[model samples]
Target: MSGVVEGLEGRVFTVLGAAGFVGQRVVSRLRAAGAEVFAPARGDPALWTRPLGHVVYAAGLTADYLVRPFDTVEAHVGLLARVLKEAQWESLVYLSSTRLYDSLGAVDAHEALPLRLDPGQPRHLYDLSKALGESLCHTQGQGRARVARLACVYEGAQDADGFLPSLLRQVMAAGAQPGAPRPAIEVPSSPSFERDYVHVSDVVEGLVHLALRGQHTIYNLASGENTSNASLFDGLGRRWACELRATLPAGPSEAPRIRIDRMREEFGWRPKGLHSVLDAMKETCP
Candidate 1:
């Protein structure tokens, strides 16, 4: 993404979660476009030389571990803070999450949504950390950093857990069921419940967009379309005849529709709809 880097060609663009789904794609996109992508988790500090182009901090551990808690949010916040202070980068594109807001759970929400952090309540540490990290970046970077608030990023099939692998397995499975279970996602989620699913590529584009120009602006990088899990399953099952099932109901009454208006207005980035998302998954599925 030299276009994304503009004048940062040959400069080190440190990607933290290099082995992750999104990180891998970002690395590929950058390397393919002739950018020097450095994966920090794979090695030592020597690899991370000076003149860092854009520290795309996407590394994160889920808040699944609650008993013996590790402060991942503070760690990432400190990491970015250190990177910004020491690394030789013009700006940063920290990949924050839409999970920071409950409004982001059911439908579209702008950046104006409330992010009330309750120390008493148990929550996904990742989300809490994301909010903290974003706050740090904004406070520190001021006008030199950009926060790309991403929605759910996926491209491949899903698994038993409604992830990409599960979806893919259902689609490519032998003698796939296509009518009743033609893909039934049983979520307590209302047919009215919606989520803004963002394709990995589109998220990358928004990051690339901000990486090249916008700074310190929090842009919601999403498809801006509220897609119900049932609708998504039905559409794909109709075409692929694969079964997608969800046994549990969805929580969070709010329609967490993520808005991408800022991304569109700022970087001229518009994500492809869910229909195309399924089509791409079908092709990518084995």
Candidate 2:
């Protein structure tokens, strides 16, 4: 993967959710590339202060968005609106999710898919908020914004609330003591269920490329591979040499994967596979 280049040198960047998992990685990458960065943590003194030259809107929720609907809207749409209106930015990158493509029945959801979301559904708030955010970026940015619909970004324990992280943590903990009694890693959903997992570092790479040099306004940053839960556990079991038992319950069908050709062709970037993510986590495990 290409490291951040001198193209970003001397450029000023304002990351809204600077403290977040993705935001932090982005800030680190930008600063490492010699760009001046303003990263405000949640509720910090510089929440929305300093002018934003190149803005990366990495602020948003996932698991907690449903519980806090109003907060979700505020973070996803409200703050984004404020940035678009108040901030002085040359280019903006709005971090969106592949979850927005859930309602579309296509096996491979593309950017051109016409989204038809039912607002009456309680769970649709997350989708609705993101949809609105994308709208704001497209209409408000006036061709200066890039909308990145990220896949399930796996960052190990940093993203513990997510499915892959939770499962990885449980399996690793259970395998920590070899030859000892290990607890079953309980998966809330079925093992056969598949998902698209992109490494956080790869997501940051894609985001940075999009923010700096992408031509298309909308793109999907993903590994372009559909991996099942069973496959993930098998990957873990092969490395740990422990009997990994996961209790999985039958759940709803899986959502379709998103296309990444736009990202590949436009940005000339390809994300690493899920197995690479698993290997990285194992090497980092203490």
Candidate 3:
């Protein structure tokens, strides 16, 4: 433990959703830090998850993610139940969403803010399922679980789950070349709606820190900054050295802004800002 980070040297960790964007990053970080990470293949827990040192449950699905919600919810719930029942590790980090937080118009929210979305809200089937899964983990892992309730994480490559891709499509559409009509860029999001957007790297840092600390704490893992789509497009334009503009639509959907005080206090995780994201997009764009 002298050279390697403490509490992780030679440890066996299990990561659900290892193929996912976030799960893959978490697994890589764990492997780099000298932890043997196990990933349950296709929701099968019995295949490769026996001596678990830590568990990072990052598996999720949605309309944008895949085909449907109900098709994936059972597998997730079953996998979670199995993990809780067989958590040989001292600690577990469940990846819950900030969507459960109230859609507080423009209010800043914290971990203490009660999740206002009814456990049975039917608007988004995915949100409802996530709430149920979180409830299960919270109940079973009362004192042993470290629930890392995360916000939007932008790698800036091609994740359509958030506002980035849609906004990018709009801007690109705005530049639709000669002869080709430039589709309208919706004005409502010209100033991107403010959401707790965190970079995936910082998210990994927070998750890794929580996994090893054994604090049994639930923390809000966010960017700790207020950001809008307008700022994002401006940054992208600078990165590409081209004018990026969009039409501001009326009354964009706004989610609660989560405060990341607990993340900073616990793991010292400060997310990369909009400029960093733009730079990432620049490098990633072909």
Candidate 4:
């Protein structure tokens, strides 16, 4: 609840994918909290060697995973396997995603919900690879690994490609042209589709809490509320005078919400909502 990594000072933490979005945030927090953090350059086996006190495996792909399945597998599974096999760490936290629940057809599901990733569908590689990574941490770490199934994390001002980021970029672009007509954000699917979103900072806090004192092997780090594209874009309109250029066929789509009770009950962690995200965008707009 204090937003500080407990006992962060005088600890050595090794973070993989330290150049990435989440990894960068984690490393920044570690340094700010006075932890001895090691972030090796990604993809070099030799650089991975470090005296680890706690490990955070934050490497993997998202939108490009389908095009680069082999690389995705290597990052999500192979690298983690290599680390678990070699590292002597006090505790490890494996960063996973709530997308693993996509195929399960359950809304607001908990960690106990069963998951199935169809192998025939090549697109499922992302989800399957992440699931395999979670399995590796749970099994190999031997009670030392804690897995955080993060929701859609957006830093608001980053160049990353995701629903909220795309909207944030469009809004910021519109603000550049004074007196211009409201910019339109294209929606690729049913506007009714919704999902949970969490800020990167909140996720970092939860990750730190899990790494330091968590007893559970798996936890869902999310905002605990579903926001539909229609509702979210409408809210954006209020802030930036934007419009939705929806281009998908009208039909049903998966709406993914998740329960964060476990994360709250276990670690006293909760996410800051979209309003806070908007406030951050106003301050950090590029």
- Which number leads on TM-score? 4
Q: Give the distance in Å from residue 105's predicted Cα in candidate 3 to where it truly belongs.
A: 2.7
Question: What is candidate 4's local distance difference test score?
Answer: 0.81
The list of candidate 1 runs beyond 4 A from truth reads: 1-11, 47-49, 63-68, 103-108, 158-164, 174-193, 242-253, 283-286
- Report the alpha-carbon TM-score of model 1 versus the true structure: 0.81
User: Per-residue lDDT for 147 in model 3?
Assistant: 74
lDDT of 1: 0.67
Each model's TM-score? 0.81, 0.89, 0.80, 0.91
Stretches of candidate 4 above 4 Å error?
Answer: 1-3, 43-50, 175-185, 279-286
Model 1: ten consecutive residues of lowest lDDT: 183-192
On the 0 to 100 scale, the lDDT of residue 242 in model 1 is 56
Candidate 4: tens digits of C-alpha lDDT, residues 1-286? 3445566788888888898889999999999989999887866565445568888888888889888889999999998898888866888899999988888664667998888789898888888899999999878988989899988888775657777787777776775356777767777767777778888888999888888888888999899988777777777766776677668755465756688889888766767887767765666653
Candidate with more favorable, higher TM-score: 1 or 3? 1
Q: Pick the candidate with the highest lDDT.
A: 4
User: Model 1 over residues 47-135: C-alpha lDDT tens digits?
Assistant: 34756667777776553436434646544575777777776776788888777766244534787667756565666556676787788
Better of 1 and 2 by TM-score: 2
In candidate 2 the C-alpha lDDT for residue 33 amounts to 84
lDDT of 2 at 169: 66
Return the TM-score for candidate 2, rounded to 2 decimals: 0.89
